[model samples]
Structure formats: C-alpha cells, structure tokens
Target: MPGQENMTDVTVIRGNVYERLSHVIDPEIGRSVTDLGMIVAIDVAPSHSTEGVRAPGRFDVTVHVELTVPGCPLTQTIQDRIDEAVASYPGLELVPHIEVGAMDADKLTGLVSSLKAERRENPFNKPGIKTRIFAIASGKGGVGKSSVSANLAATFSALGYDTAAIDADIYGFSLPGLFGVHSQPTNLNGMLMPVTAWGVKLISIGMFAGADRAILWRGPRLQRSLEQFLSDVWWGQPDVLLLDLAPGTGDMAISVAQALPNAELVVVTTPQPSASDVAVRSGLVALQVPLKVRGVVENMSYFDHAGERLRIFGEGGGTRVSDRLTDALGYDVPLLASLPLEPDIREVGESGRPAVLDSDGSLADTPLASSFTALARRLIG
Candidate 1:
C-alpha cells in the first residue's frame, strides 16, 4: 500500500512540477524553460526517511536543464527560478535538485537558427510591433543626453515596464559605464543578448573592448553600427526602448528614423542659452525625418541648496527649446521636466549606478526619481 501511494504521489508531483516550470522564464531568452527546450527531463521521487520508509507528502524533484551555453552569467538566476518554482508547490514539501549542462552543438545550432528565423531582420520595423522608441538627443556635447537616457531607462524598468536602451552614441558610448555594466553581451552563435543592468536590457559599443571594439569601428559608415545593433541583438519586443544618440543633429537621428519609423525624439538641453539654442536644432531634425519631436528636458535646471533654489546655469533653456521646436514643427512639444543640478547624479552615476536608483536597483525615493517617473509617464502617454 505504501509503495502504491508513493508511486501515485510521484506521478502527480512530476506533472505539477512540469506545469510550474512552464511559468519560469529564461531571463536572457525571455521564454519559459519548458518552451526553450531547456528542461530535458523532470524526475520526481518520494523522499526516504533514515529508516528507509517513504516520507508522506515529501518528494525530491531533479530537473535536468540544458542551458543554451556553458558558464552563462545568468545560470545562477535560472537555477534560482527553478528552485523557487519547485519549492513553492502547494500542500507538499518539494526539494529541488537542478542538474545543469550546456546544449550539444547540434541542439545549440538548431535553437539559434530557429530564434534567428523567428526574428528576421530588424524586429522593431515590423508593423504592429508594440515597442515605444524614444531617441534622446542634444544639439551638442556636455548636455547630459546619455545621463538622461540611462536614468530614464532605469526609471521605466523600475516602474514595471519591459525596458531596453541603446548607446546609439557609438564613439561616445556612456550607458555601459552609467549603468555599471562591465561584461560583454553573451553571444549565442551569431545573435547577441543585451546585458541586463539596473533592470534595463542594454547594448552598446562600450560593452565591447580591444579588438572587438576595433572590429565594430572598422566600417566607414556610422549607420552600419546602428543597423547591426538593431538586427544582430535579440531584443524580445521590449515595451519601451531608449537610444542615447551622439551629441549633435546628424546621421544617427536619420538612421533611427529610417530603421525605426515610429521613434519619437526627446531633446535634452541645459539652462544655458548656448546649449538650448542648439538643442532646438536637434529636435528640428524631426522636420527632415518622419520622427516625432516628443518634448524637451532641461537638465541642470537649478540647484537646491538648503531651502532655496539657485538657478546655477541661468534659466528658460527648456522653454526656449520647447517653444522653438513647437513653432518649427507645428506641434505641441512641451518642456517635459526641468531636472535639478545635483552632485549625486554625477557621483552615483560615475560609481556605475544611475542616481535615480538605489544600490538595490529600485527607484530611489527622491525628487529626482519623482521627476523621472513623471517624465516617463508623459513620454508613454
């Protein structure tokens, strides 16, 4: 009777474990373990006591997982998800044992081929794709365009959006350092997986180093790099995508318009007239291209010292950009937010963390975070 009961339990638990694992997603691929063919097998057996008797409602679940690659940085994350799925089975004590291995050459090849086929060419260009693309640009350098891109991407992720960012500023790539991402993206065959940092999926030329970086820079045309980033990387249809464009009103913006017709431009400016004057031109590129000029963000608008707000960089730069773009484009391009000049934005950011977020990766409870949250909501709307 005991043996018969144990057999019944094993069958039920195995089925349940398999079902639960279907909900556990592989972080990089953004697909369930079962769907990705990673779950080679699920073996469930009753737990035996020291006396060699079956322990009621207790079982050991051994999950055989074949990862796409060996020594994956996310291997531990996937294992933890599996462990949580098994251990949380209702009304029973399930101990999880995960045996991980890399997929065989043939199997890995097949998987990569299938994924590539499904994601033919640039995924964002497909009609009916639900990704919101925002290209952050500035008229010139030193306007904090990259900083805005990095922090805004982090805010979107913290607010529970499936967010991705690109350091479209090829030669001036800064998102990698801002987000504190050090490792290169995991290359699966020919496809690349954007490194996840501060909850945002990110790809940048800065992530590559030495020969790899040189190889990317070998091509004469700058647009080729943007094209490769769009097609070569597997993006999995993010809800919001941000691009930190290279400072100036040139090739990158046009490339984005051609590659992503639905992209909206967000111009960044400082409180100074010189920066804002050029920033307006950055948004005016929308006239030449089909891209929409979403709005303007004035960074370093002021400094909050004690109870008084000091206009450190002068004032009305955001307004100047917004009004000029609105008049030139014949659309309502409002000044989204006037961000304060804070030292933390620089200090924390240089330390490889977005200032809007805490060390734990959640949005920090600060005025800057609030401004970003509001800015994110407006952009999405």
Candidate 2:
C-alpha cells in the first residue's frame, strides 16, 4: 500500500513539474512549449523499483518534449531547462526525452495566436485568478495622467487593496521614476515577478530600460514586446491592474484592445476647452476597442486659491467631456471630480510620492484628490 501511494504521488508531482517547466520559453518560437501543447506525457517511478540503481527516496521523471515543427533547433534548450527544474525538487531525479513532431506551419502559427488571445481574456471572469485590469488614459499629456495613475495605485495599497500598475506607454515610459523603483525584472524559469513600490505592485518599461534612452522599435517589434510583457510576467492576481496609456491612439492602444478585451477604461483630462476636445478623442478611440468608459476625472480643473476659486483654466471641462462621452456612447458619463492644479503635484511624482499622500489637510476637497478618490471608489466597486 505504501508503495502504491508513493507511485501516485510521484505521478502527481510529475504533472506539476511539467506545468512549471512549461513557463520556460523557447528562444525560437517566443512562447513556452507548454502553451504550445507540445508536452506529451510524464512518467515517474522510484529509482529503486528498477532492477538496479536503487535510490530509495528518489524518483526518476521523464518528460516528453515534443517539437511543434520537425527538426526545431531549440529542442535542447527546452530539454535542459526541464531537466534542471525537475532536478531541483527534493526526492526526484529528471530524465529528458526529445521527440520531433510536425504541425503544418499555418497550424503552428495559429496555436501561437490563440495562446496570446487566451491570456487577454478576462482572467477575472475565469476561475483561476482574481486580477482586475484598469487602463488609465488621458486626452493629452501634461495633465498629471501618469502621476495620478502611480499615486492612486499607491493609495489603493495604503488602504490594503493589493494593486498593480502597467506603463503601456511603450515609448514614453515613466513608471519607474514615479515609484522610485529601479531594477531589471527577475526571470524565474522565464516568468518575471512584478516589482513592488510603496505597497503597490508595478510593471514598466522604465524598469527594464533607461529614462533618457529612446526606444526605436517598429510596429511588429513593439507588438512582440508588449505581448511578451503580458505572457511572461507572473502578476499573481492583485485587486486591480492599472495601465498608464499614452496620449494618443495608435498601435499600442490596438494591441491592448486585442490583449485585454475585457479591460475597463478611465479617461483623464484637464479643464481646458482644447484639452477637453483632445481628451474626448481618447474616449472615442477607446470606443473603437469597445471598452466601457467608466467615468471621467478633470485634472487641473482649477488652481485652488486658499478659500476662493482661482478659475485658471475655466470650469466645466470635466462636465463637458463627461457629457460628450455620455451622448456619444449613449449613456451617463459622470464627470467624477476635478483636480485643482497644484505645484506640489509635480514634486510628488518626481520625488516618488503621490500628492494625495504627501500633501496635508482636506485634500479631499481639493480638485485632484477629490476626483482621484471618487474615481477609485467607482472603479473598485
């Protein structure tokens, strides 16, 4: 009986090991063999059960590494990694087996495409994970969009909600500095863990790259990189995942649409007519993805003059954009709140502190804080 149970345990462990091993990427296909469904079988038996070579506690594992295409060059890379991962487990020994298989090139490519599609589907709606996806976008830049995204994510953490933010701005990545985090993402069997900052979880190109450097990439290259970001990172299902979207509609936005079809959108804009008009375009662009625009936050709605309103950029831009979105989208787009222009807003972002946290006294009544808190409540609920 003891021997029988041990055999069952070994079999289970073999499957788990294979699952873990699948996370490893093949250099050629840019995807893991597991996602490709190239893993065929797993077998495990106590080394001692064999006629010779008795290692009592140790079990031997053999994993079938099937190639999607015949004569694939990266076969050995996959085998070596599987061998290493299985060997790391105590009470186990690994044996690698490589098999050559063939799928028509078109079928192989289709498999890769479907794997990418499955990931962007609502993981929240799926049974396995509790990750919430949030896309933060602005009508234009210089309206504190990135700063608000970083701080709101940080604030959610202070309130005890596990939060994460992604800088989807491809070319204009500013997330690393906003959180003051610096480090290349650590790769575990090819899966990278998200970096933590101020109690919030984050992923940004800035972490993997330099701020002063220009990322010169063609559309295909950009797609591949963003695609890898979603598939390769182990996000671990936080309460929410925020994205700092770039200022206009282009390839990056379309990629996000393809990947996170269920993603919710939050639009940010300043309280200026021209800004509002431009910001409206962002909402319209999101409509192309058909993403639901939850609400609107008016940044720099005004410059608070102590107890008086210093109507700097004029009022109602938030309301205007909200009304326009509601009309165009045929629903109520509540102008959530307005953020008063404050000099400290800049300082906090540069210092890696959110204005909502570093500033004192009734910030709730302040334009920016008011909008941020209200938006947070709406999105989270």
Candidate 3:
C-alpha cells in the first residue's frame, strides 16, 4: 500500500485535485478550465483534511462538468483529459468520476456576456493621442457590415489617414477572408500584431479558424475571443479604429459597448422599408448601451434599370431608418451614404479591395466614394 492513503486524507486531497483541474485548457477556445465555468460541482468522501491525514487514505474523487450543448462532440476527450490530469496528481490514487451535463443556450450567453463585461476599459486607449472608434453595425444579417468596414478602413488609409479595423464578429468573422489573407496574428510579448493590407491594419479570428472544420460556437468563448482581439492586439493609436460588428443586438455588439465607450455607432441598412424598420431596432438597441448613433449608410439601395427604378429590396428603407433614428436615437442621424446596386462594390470586396479604390470603372462614378469622403471629414471634425 505504498500509495494508499487514509479515508479522511483522500477527501482533502480531492479538493486539491479540483483546484488543479482549473489549469486544463478547453480544446476549442484555448482558455483555462476555470474561465469556461465548466466545473459544476465537486464531491469528496467524508473525513477530509490536509493536516489531519491518517495512514490508509481512502481513494475517491468526483468532478462535474457543464457542457454548452447536448451530446457535446468532445465529451470523451474532455473526460479522458481530466482523468489523466487527476491520475498524475500525487497522493491521488483513483481517477475522479467525471460528471458531464449541458448548459442551455441562454445560460451560455449570460456567461459570455459577463466575460465581456469583465473587460470594460478600452485596452488600446494609450496616453497622449486622439483616436476615433467607429463600430459599423447592422439591423440584421447580410446587411454588409464587414464589406462596409473594410472599404472604410482602406479608403481612410488611402487618403493618408492612419486607420485600423477590428473584426468584432467573433463567430461570423468575415474580415480576414475579405482581405485574401490567411495568416494568424503573431504574439509579440503577448501583444498580437494585426495583418496589414491596403495600408490598413486588420485583426480577425477568421485567420486562426480552420476552413475545413466548423463547430457550434457558444457564449462566453465568443465574448472572450472578441475581448482577446481588443486586449491582445498591437493596435496602433490611429486617427480612427473601425469595428466590423456582427449583425443584430448580440453579445459581440454588447462587447463593443462595454469595451469602446468613446466609439460612435454607425448602423448599416438597406433601402427597403422593412429593412429600415429592423435597422431602426438596432439603433434602438445601441441606445440601450448608451452608444451615440452617428448615422446610417444604406447599401445596395436600389438597382438602376435603364433609369426606371427596380426597387428590388423595397423603397424608403434608408429614409425610414433615418427618420426613426431622429425620434428613437434622440438625434438627427442622416442617411450617410446610399450605395446603388453596383456590382463593382461586391467585386472589389470579394477581391479584398474597397470599391472606393476601383479606378477606370463604373464604380469610379458611383456615389459611395464621395459620401465616404464626406463622412470621413464629418467624423474628424
């Protein structure tokens, strides 16, 4: 019985074992066990005390884990890893029983929200400089938030303004792919450096995600990942910092509200009245965060079919949202820009270039560029 320990001693040792489990990293997110809040409970048999350990210590330990979804694909892996970790502990002779349970989506979202709220201060607000933070947001998915942000960043930099863009859509990140870059940010003394393209600095989790593999990403991890993007990135003090936020009033948007207090909210929407209606809600949600509603940019507003308007998505959406913002946001948020149904805007975005930089094309005559330039001046002033 070289390793046998007393019953009371074994119980005390189980408590120590639980504390050690905090060091295990979640395979998917690379965060230590404690951040996940995975451990639901711990049980040690009666008779426990580090100082009161007698000979012949009983061997017993149990660990409970809460999963985010049912039939968690990594259940076996997590169990085995925990078992191994426990086995390696000295004076612990038995593998602790691992209890697995799933947490509902709402509970997961709350945990993620709290994770983001923990980092309320703007980590990049360095001393002695002026920087404007702009969060490009939308009322719904597919409103072109990422595309608009990329063009704005590139356009700003092309005009000699030092600019950076953070892909704040942690789960639906589309910035890195938009730039045609596949490299991950390197950690330099813990500060991650952003990938540079078109004279604009960029950081995105997309660069770290593998395209061949996908998973159902849930709450706290999403917020923590976005937080890392803000806290760890070597974002230079620039004239402006653009954030490509995920669509809707979700955790990532809330993270923006908590982290970037000085940032202005720029909502993106379409011209359809229905689209405008939903877009208005996004601004209303921003008001909940106490975000200043800057203005709205209507993209793909309409298609010019031989002078007669096609009105594909519907009419007056941008105007509708603009008017609603005046009443709801308590400010006159003008219709900032109306990008007509120009394929070149999509082409440039797909090609990792902003439409504003497309020369010798119909896009050169489009209304997006002029509006963007004017918007920039208004922002700086």
lDDT of 3 by residue, 69-164 (tens): 566545687788888877787754554788888776777767555544543435554454488888998988877778788877776877788788
**Residue 254 lDDT (model 2):** 71
Report the backbone clash tally of model 1: 0
Model-by-model lDDT, in order?
0.91, 0.71, 0.72
How are the candidates ranked when ordered by lDDT, highest leading? 1, 3, 2
Query: How many clashing pairs in candidate 3?
Result: 9
State the lDDT of candidate 1 residue by residue for 118-179, as single tens digits.
99989998989999999999999998888899899999999999999999988778888899
Which residue pairs show backbone clashes in model 2? 139-279, 338-367, 339-367, 339-368, 340-367, 340-368
- Of 1 and 3, which scores higher on TM-score? 1
Using TM-score, rank the candidates from best to worst.
Answer: 1, 2, 3
Question: Residue 36 lDDT in model 1?
Answer: 85
- In angstroms, how far off is 229's CA in candidate 2? 1.9
Query: Who wins the TM-score comparison?
Result: 1
For model 1, what is the error of residue 373's alpha carbon versus the real structure, in angstroms, after optimal superposition? 0.8
Q: Model 2, 1-381: lDDT tens per residue?
A: 756887787778877787777777654444676776777677776666456866756776767666665655445767677677777765555544444565666765676466445655334446556666778788778777888788678667666677777788878888888777876665433455567667676677787746468888757787676667776665556788888888877677776777776677778888879888888888887667868787788877776575887878887888888999999998777877677688877876788767666433123344566566766776788
How far off is residue 345 in model 2, in Å? 1.6
